[model samples]
Target: QPFTYTTAPVPALTSLTPTSGPTTGGTTVTLTGTGLATVGAVRFGATPAASFTVVSDTHITAVAPAGTGTVQVTVTTPGGTSNGISYTYSAAPTLSGVTPNQGPTSGGNTVTLTGTNLTGTTAVTFGATPATSFTVLSPTQITAVVPAGSAGPVTITVTAPGGTSALPSAYFYVSPPVLTGVAPPSGPLSGGNTVTLTGVHLIEATAVRFGTTAASGFTVVSDTQITAVVPVGAAGLADVTVNTAGGTSNPVSYTYLPAPVVTTLIPSQGPVSGGITFTLTGTNLAQTTTVLVGGTPAGFTVVSDSHIVVDALPGAPGTVNVTVTTPGGTSAPKTYTRVGSPGI
Candidate 1:
């Protein structure tokens, strides 16, 4: 009598559960299909997984190994290797910093995150709340829009195939600073003027600046007030900004008026005996009305808004100021030269 021989059939892998995870390791994946009882080895791409267990003739569970990019998964038994199944490997992304971590409650604000292993980011969340929009700019950077949230701080997290990375130490807040008012709209070039600012959320003020020039003196008086000394600056209008931990306030206009300017004298020559009618031209004149010749005040007449006729009072020969003033400001002094004989 002769003995008989027979061949066994090889099993095919039909599906796999949770086909992805971090390259650092530790992800249990389930393989499902017929003929899994005789599985010899489980591999995720070219890297073989560890601690694989056969649950039934049709199912097997294996822990994923650390790797990068995409790879083909398969099972090897005494019969042979089955058809390859695809699995993706990824690394957790990190966050170094978030530009402008604060935003409005209504949300919809784009923020940039910088760090490492940020490629293939699947999602971003703010304290468990999903972001409205997200984009992977590169392996080290990601852009995400803030979702609607309450006024407070919340942790930000990013998720990828490898796994979710550690939460960033820094948190994002919702409320921003609001500017109410600024004092002393106009100041001299010498600065040193103390201007009080009133606003909300001003306690964490970091810096104060007059235009682009940093202020010489600054103090946070309260959550709604800031006192700062204006730095010496040129004549013109400039914006005053107060920066705080929350953010920077809207720029306030700081007017820098030039010193009183002196133009020409109305009457080039006057009688040495005095009483000469003259007008003056210039800018930023003081509000007080007075006439002076070489700094000497002479009796003057207010003819109009821009002109002043002055009758030189018993003064010696030479020039004098024919100045006019109003609530708005003063006019520059005009010189009136006095001659021995009075002539126009």
Candidate 2:
């Protein structure tokens, strides 16, 4: 009688531990099936794997070779080749820019990132610190909440299955500004006055506000100085503050005075030779800085908040206008008749 002949059963693939990897692939995947102990080769599509190791008759660990798109993974043995399993390759993500790249060191601001191939992001970082949170909006965009950090520039990075990418000097943390003083802390209620602001960490100022009104204009003179034109507001105290990329500064007090008024004038008449003195009366006159008689400046002394003595200057024999100016504003003119001695 001839000896009986036998054949080994064909290998059958049950599943793959991980079904996907990067296009530049170097992923280790676990292949589970029967008759794997005798597995002689593992092929990903038509390309052979970088390496492989048969752990047992039902399991094998293999390193996938570099690949693109999707491909079929198969195993070969003396028994037979197993059924194919699907594997996908992903592309590496990129970073192009970060909007509003600068923020306060205290963080809590949302910033948008733009780039290519950004799907399935795993992590986002500022320097070595992870973002407070992040959400992927599209394959080319992501919105992330910033994390608190020290004041200065830091690199931003994103990680995905493909790999990690970084943008050097990408984001900056700024310290909030401080306010020490405001020069000439008072101005006219009508505005249009420039004031100096002194403080620390005042760079990159974005706004200067008086009470709730924004400054007409401003210039950053230095980290400790700024010249801002006041905005009109009601007569009273207004809080002045400066804003920068870091944050809003501490508020300082500012006073806005109402315009002065001229209600009376002594005698209301003076000689054309004009060596005569006149008493002027009005509200808000304590700050009187100037007195004009018919467009000509006259010497004056502030007697009180409601009175002042002005020496009338020589002028033609006729009625002339007299006005007063103070920090509040210029006053309405008053008639001062100048008479010629005895109509000769």
Taking the candidates one at a time, how many backbone clashes does each contain? 9, 0
What are the per-residue Cα lDDT tens digits for candidate 1 across 1-344? 99988555577899888877787778899999877888889988778897699999899999988788788889988777889888877767777788777766667778888778887787889887898999999888888898887777788888876667655545556455667878867766778778888888787788888999999889999989999988888877888887765557798888876555557665577677765465555555543355556666666655443445556665577665555443223456555666666469
Candidate 2: list runs displaced more than 4 Å. Answer: 1-18, 30-41, 52-61, 76-79, 262-282, 285-324, 333-344
Model 1 CA deviation exceeding 4 Å by range: 1-9, 14-17, 30-72, 76-80, 100-107, 149-153, 184-195, 203-223, 227-327, 331-344
Per-residue alpha-carbon lDDT of candidate 2 for residues 1-344, written as tens digits (9 for 90 to 100) = 89987787788889986887778889999999898888889999999888999999999999999999889899999889999999877788899999999999999999999987788888999999999999999999999999999999999999876777888999999999999999888889989999999999887999999988999999999999999999989988999999998999999999999998999999799799988899999899988889999999999999899999999889898999999998888999999999989955
Weakest 10 consecutive residues, lDDT, candidate 1?
A: 322-331
Candidate 1, residue 68: Cα displacement in angstroms equals 7.8
Best prediction by lDDT: 2
Each model's lDDT: 0.74, 0.92
Question: Which candidate leads the pack in TM-score?
Answer: 2
